[model samples]
Target: MILIIAKALVKDESLELFKREALELVKNSRGEDGCIEYSVYEDQEKSSVMTFVEKWEDRAAIEKHEGTEFFKEKIGRLISYSENIEITLNSEVL
Candidate 1:
């Protein structure tokens, strides 16, 4: 299994729109093949800070998701709303 963590510092003016798009992204991604889990979170003290946590069967599953039209579109939009972003991948310990 693999875990993906995407953290972003969103622009203040784009907060609402970012949440809307991210919600749809999470919902759609959850239904994809090999999607073990997908969720989004916000920092209570810093609303502009957002995170996306995803669990997949493997790297191939993540690649498949990245190739999806909605994924491409939404991710592009999300990135546009962010001041900065960081992404990391992890492998589950056996």
Candidate 2:
């Protein structure tokens, strides 16, 4: 399995728009094959900080997701509006 933790910092004024876009991304991501889980959440202390927690069956699944048009479009829009973004990938050691 593969896990991805994606973080994005939005401008305070762009928070609402970021939430809406995030919800749409979650909905669409959940429908893709090999997507084990998809969720979006706001940081408790910083409203402008948003994170997406994603689980996939494997690296191939994650790569397939990256190639999807949905990811391309939405991620592009997010990059345009977000102040900062980062993605981290992990896997079980045992």
For 1-94, candidate 2 gives per-residue lDDT tens digits of 9989999999878788788888989999999999999999889998889999999999988889989998998888888779999999999899
Report the Cα lDDT for residue 11, model 2: 83
After superposing candidate 2, which stretches have Cα over 4 Å from the reference? none
Candidate 1 lDDT, 1-94, residue by residue in tens: 9999999999999999999999999999999999999999999999999999999998899999999999999999999999999999999788
Q: Looking at candidate 1, what is the lDDT of residue 23?
A: 99
What RMSD, rounded to one decimal, does every model reach?
0.6, 0.9
Could you tell me how far off, in angstroms, the CA of residue 7 lies in candidate 1 after the best superposition?
0.4
Maximum-lDDT candidate:
1
Q: List the residue pairs that clash in candidate 1.
A: none
Full-model lDDT, candidate 2: 0.90
